[model samples]
Target: METDSDVELAVRPAPHPWLVLREHAHLVPMISLGGALGALGRWGLAQAMPHPAGAWAWATLWTNLGGAFLLGLLMSCVLTVWAHTRYVRPLLGVGVLGGFTTFSTAELDTRGLVAAGHPGEALAYVATSVALGLVAIMLGLGLGSALLRRGRPRRVTP
Candidate 1:
């Protein structure tokens, strides 16, 4: 039994992936620019604080932690302050922070430490990075919320 609703559903065309991409094509430039700048900043940090193969990768550690904090802060601002602004998330969150943070490099650093017969150091590094990254995000979110509250004008009713 082919009802009118069933016929309409069967005749409806599925959206092409290309059309979906085209709809948000305008964000490409912002994301690309942000990503480039983030990568450059990460590279500069690495250059400034280069470590040996088996040593703690301070540069990568700081970069990841910083990126995580910034992401949390940015999300808070986006939700509370810039809720209506388009492209901020795609540019800063998806692009800049995405480019700045390097999980692959972190994994490689851990592997290097393990290969150099420092399993304990590797474990400690991983644990410390995860713990500190989480703490950093929480701090960032709290700071962002506090700043927003401070900036707002309070209403007084007597």
Candidate 2:
């Protein structure tokens, strides 16, 4: 006999690349706009706070952590009630936040730090970035979920 999990698996449609792309076609432009804005913002910030190779890069750390938090908050709110809207996720989460958080830059920073004879700092920076980023995201998610739940009306059963 098929188990409940098996039944659910059978009932669910398997993901197809073409179908996924078609479904999200409308989001392309929204994501593109958000990405452009996000990248520009990051570039502006980096310009404002230029750091040498192998030094502590505060701007990037802040940007990534901030982006993670915002992404979490946006996702929480969207998943809770605004999930029906297609624009929000693509515009904010996939486009803005994704573009804002640069793993490539992070890798470059770490590599530079190591190459600059600051392996200890490089290790610390990487560890702290990942750990704090996760914490920030969770915190934002919790706060957003709580706020949304508070605004929702409680159900009454007779």
Candidate 3:
């Protein structure tokens, strides 16, 4: 027999490595779509935003940061609200946005930071991103949970 806490521990879900890989299975389509949208959005921004000479790279930086921040916010909403349903989290988070962003590019940026003699900045950037990203997701989950719980009408005896 298990106590409530024991049962909670027993049922605790740890993220699966294979789940990440498997998520890639569906990510192909999600990325295909999200990337197309991101590309168009980037193009529009380039045309719309003013830029300095010899700065083609600025658009990319803007796009990636914008994407990450938007992803953090959108992911929070999806994870919290729609997350009440089965398969929602994986499809959106693991599939769509996961495919949208590039970890490979992030790694490259980290390497560039080191090469640029900013190893400390690189380390701090990585740490801050990881920590903040986690916190954002957690906050989003908590908000959605509260909304869902609160939306349910409480039963009271007259």
Off by over 4 Å in 3: 1-91
Question: After TM-score superposition, what is the CA distance of residue 149 in candidate 3 from its true location, in Å?
Answer: 1.3
Among all windows of 10 consecutive residues in model 1, the one with the lowest summed lDDT is 2-11
Residue pairs with colliding backbones in model 2 are none
Task: For residue 92, give model 3's deviation from the true position in Å.
Answer: 1.9
Total backbone collisions, model 3: 0
* Per-candidate RMSD, Å: 4.5, 3.6, 7.3
Q: Rate the local accuracy (lDDT) of all candidates.
A: 0.91, 0.88, 0.58
Off by over 4 Å in 2: 1-23, 153-158
Q: Candidate 2 residues 1-158, lDDT tens each?
A: 75676445546768998999898788889999999889988888788888987899888998899998998899799987887986888898888888888867988999999999999999999999999999999989998999998999999999
Task: Give the TM-score (vs. native) of candidate 2.
Answer: 0.84
TM-score of each: 0.85, 0.84, 0.52
Pairwise lDDT winner, candidates 1 and 2: 1
TM-score of 3: 0.52
lDDT of 2 at 145: 95
Top-lDDT candidate index? 1
